[model samples]
Target chain A: MSNLKGWKEIPIGGVIDKPATSRLYKTGEWRVSRPVIDREVCINCMQCWLYCPDMSIEGSIEGKRMKLGEFKMEYCKGCGVCAAVCPVNAIVMKPESEFIDE
Target chain B: MPVKLTVTGAHAVAQAMRQINPDVVAAYPITPQTPVVEYYATFVADGMVDTILVPVESEHSAMSAVVGAAAAGARTMTATAANGLALMIEIVYIAASYRLPIIMPLVNRALSGPLNIHCDHSDAMLARDSGWIQFFTENHQEAYDFTIIATKLAEKENVLLPAMVNLDGFITSHGVESFEMLDDEVVKEFVGTWNPKYSLLDTENPVTFGPVDLFDYYFEHHRQQEEAMNNAYEELPKVFEEFAKISGRKYDFLDLYKTDDADYIMVVMNSTASTAKYVVDELREEGKKVGLIKPQVFTPFPKKEFQKALNGRKGVVILDRAMSFGKEAPLYSLIKSALYEVPSRPKLGSYIYGLGGRNTSPKMIRQAFEDAFNDNLVADEQRYLGLRE
Candidate 1:
């Protein structure tokens, strides 16, 4: 036990070690294209959640009213499925390279 | 009270399993391994244990069920032999990678095609690189003792890795031998309840299992498995010491019989070591300097110990029941590598013996010793015993 090296102390395996892994892993970086939802037109149908592969869509409810649907960009893989399934043309897939300066 | 029972290796291991009395036993019956699951099934049916005996359809499912049940934080065990292991090999890797402490009792047998189902190490050798602790037992007594030891060792939090307790097919599995059993209550207290660190059933935590990790994280996770393996190797002696306190049988990485001052040494594992020991004893009585080294743990192989033990010997013979096919025998290759750093290392002899369950008599074993004495052995050349020209 005394001779064990620090690298040999890693408790790693296939299971997820952290909670709210979305915050721990910024999966949005994987996106070549990002989904930008136009809140003005979002009907809060939560259609994005219905079609999201990673279920990266979220909407908070307030005062008995559902809020506008927002993309959890940290986890959205930019598959554009949410844009494709939106009932209205409220969500658009934008080139990720355009936002690289920010 | 510890009662001495004359039982076959299969039954002996089952007795240990009954003591460990894991939450799940999901083995598919195969050849020499059948009797282990059979006896365990009887324990389940007679209500001696609270285990859920899952009668899985195939070896693949058997291991899959084990992995799944283990994920749910259940203490799990399974047994298999030969092709059944070959079938379950894929998930066997998954169980280890998941860091599940599943103890499997593997009956050592030849792998198929011209299919023979008797004693050999081919089956155990197949999983050599599978990142699991491996225990090679020489007889029914060892098979029994190591099963208990493997349970506690595998479940250690820092050393959470699966393990295989290997015994030769029919040779140990069917041959009756006398073994003393630790009382169930004592064994129960010794191998205390498993409190898993990662439980799929922990709904409050809600963490992913067997999740996909791309190249970015996969390599790190693999490195962690290596660390866990090292942890097992480092921490194992403590468990062995604890077992010794209750059982009074001190265990070591290698069983070095007459090795300290011998001129010639033979290295073997599992049941073959028994025959090799008999031959060593005979040669010693005849005023010859012969010794035998049987490795108890195959994985995390004791390289330093081998280097020290065989450093100044006259000649060394490594008898492997499994061949590497187009390469030197597996055990031979490992021992040869272990000797590379020692300047005073003995000249090595590689011998492949008892393939597909061929008979390895004491006379056959003596012939290998005779080759070592005459220095008729080349380090690179492979000789055979009990094989026709």
Candidate 2:
């Protein structure tokens, strides 16, 4: 009755449609990969890079700024040697169940 | 009092166990060792020994029962053979680690797998690192003597480690011979009732006996076990001195048989040493300077005593009944390790024989001496003296 939709602040150039925001914005697609990196607690320790039997480490020894060596995902048998030799428990392998295409 | 009768080594062990009157005995009857348990069972059935003899399913269960009974503050005992010992390996480590003071009679036999039932050092060699004090007897008398000594050695409060008295399978376990059995009153006075401030079944004091130890403290527990083993060197003399007073049969780690004024020695263990001593006597009659250094106590191996015995000897030939697959025989390695740093060391030669109960005649043992002396002094073949196959 009293123009309830326009009661809030109205723009001068008619109705401007706003976009919806999502919590999962800008996150990478977690496909079937060998080494999964956690951005929060990753101190960039390269121990996994040193003793990796499959050489399955990715990203640089420094901060997560640049891409360094990538893993040959086909050859990784998931021996957990990288996890064992890790200084900080940052890089963890996602279980095969989590990567199943739903 | 002396019992001059031809009895098997099993009977000898059973008689000693009967006289000692253990509170609990749990044993499994494996071949060459069945006679011991059977004889003891007869004693138990006849009401000779005031004890509970538990008939176990396997050597593993037998050792487990002894450990529990010993933990419950009972004088416990058991016997086993080659494969039986192998099965009880894990619990053997546990029993010694817990310091249960359990005594085990091992009828030394060949470990199987070419399907052999005979005498060999396979069992004793396998258990060299299991933290038990091992004694090897060369004859019926020493076999009887060791059973009594083992009880006294294990029950000492400061040296509460498990002990094993090893007797050769058919040679000692089945062979019949006359020997002296100590008086029951003397043995009773010798092995008094076990009294411990801390025990597993002592309900008055609830304390954890075997707990899960983490790495930080597990090493310390093992170190303590090692300390107890090393403490046996000094404690054994006192225990033996006391035993001497009671039984009047004195013994030492290194039994020097006709070694005085001899320039050469054949070092050995177990029943074969008895035969070698005979050969030494024959050689001495032929004006040879050869003698026998038989180690009565194989574990806590008497390094100083052996060193003194081999001080000025020209050659020291070791006769081993056991064989190491990839390396030298265990006794050979231990002897070499013991004598490596000593000044004026003798020429060392190792001979492997009596495997799977292969007969070792005096002629074969004498051949070992000749082969050792002739084959470039430091021999390495580890020649098998007598074998059917």
Candidate 3:
């Protein structure tokens, strides 16, 4: 097996040294628009979690004890499932077009 | 003789594709690259060309479909970038090894993580060793012209290798510029019909491709690939000479600009070379004796031509837009090896700039040129362009 330490030096000769930036600003990229939940309308239901195609939705399945709906944008491919499954219409799928006019 | 219209680099490439009139195209949708296929869809929808456009679910399937189409004696083409090309990796090797002569436009983009979908050469860098003849276009005009030449070069009987034509992701893909598009009849005559000796669908004779090469014949398959790559050195110029006769734009594997008497030079590829050209012009105006060397054909990398351009140059600076994960930037290592063959080589080093859509400005190019002039300064890390800390 090759030593992993020399591998770091390899990219050093190749890697573009990145200037520091706020984590949030650094993460800005062209991403699929996804949905967020309104805590008021969520009733500890897991309908969106069951229907996600990429298994992007992550939340608890506890019965009536935990917060019903919450999803991380990191893994979400913006398939708009949470908004589509919200019984109270609390979830809204804002298309990425709103933020990026392009 | 020339008609000019403003169009995006993707549209320019699509215009060239329509002109060449390939029999089949299998393309997939990916960020920054979706525009190329989208415009081709418009061309097909408008009934401008009679071509089979296969809408594939994934890049792998897209390449597989093109491989099938090309093997059946059809001139086939495809477009993808970054993760899309990564997805097509397995079949890309198969296409080159099989000598199917499929031409693909790689709208180069950064690979994911914190998940970026913008411009970078990460995808192309990862693919350098994949046995395909790669070419990098620095502008919309070359992006359009190279596609026509690529079809002829890849289809040549002596050099039957898949060609990867790379354009900067968001920069060239979406950047609109005026380009001179060749007429359909001219391009059709330039490329001609792709006549392959061994085709899967040939009714006259049946042959098995992608056969199980049980170690005995596997090395021969790779040997054939190597031979084909070497043959590309002659085949590229032949096709380019033919293209120049019709299009009037002569091309070489490596384009030398003002390097005849310069002591120092900067080498680059892709769209960033356009900015480097501007820097070269400004430096020349100040009598600083700077020039830019850009590569039009990457794989079967024009070793002889590259060394000639570096001749008499005291120091050489290679600018690569992509970073190899566990090695020196692909361009740096490749240039180092190329220089090794020369008798009196220049001081060679590299600078990696513009990953993840970072703007590579002319100002940065000037600074890099100035840095290369200093003998005392040994730059440790690759220079980051447009980084605001």
Estimate TM-scores for all models. 0.85, 0.78, 0.77
Candidate with the greatest DockQ versus the true structure: 1
Model 1, A19: alpha-carbon shift in Å? Answer: 4.6
Rank by lDDT, descending?
1, 3, 2
The RMSD of every model to the true structure, in order and in angstroms, is 6.1, 17.6, 18.6
What are the DockQ scores of the candidates, in order? 0.27, 0.01, 0.01
B1-43 in candidate 1: lDDT tens per residue? 8999998999999999999999999988899999999999999
lDDT of 3 by residue, B199-244 (tens): 6676556555664443334555666677778888878787788888
TM-score quality measure for candidate 2 = 0.78
Question: lDDT at A62 for candidate 1?
Answer: 75
Angstrom error at residue B232, model 3 = 0.7
- Evaluate fnat for each of the predicted models and list the values in order: 0.57, 0.00, 0.00
Give residue B172's lDDT in candidate 2 (0 to 100).
88
lDDT of 1 at B40: 95
TM-score of chain A of each: 0.68, 0.48, 0.55
Cα lDDT, model 2, residue B73: 78
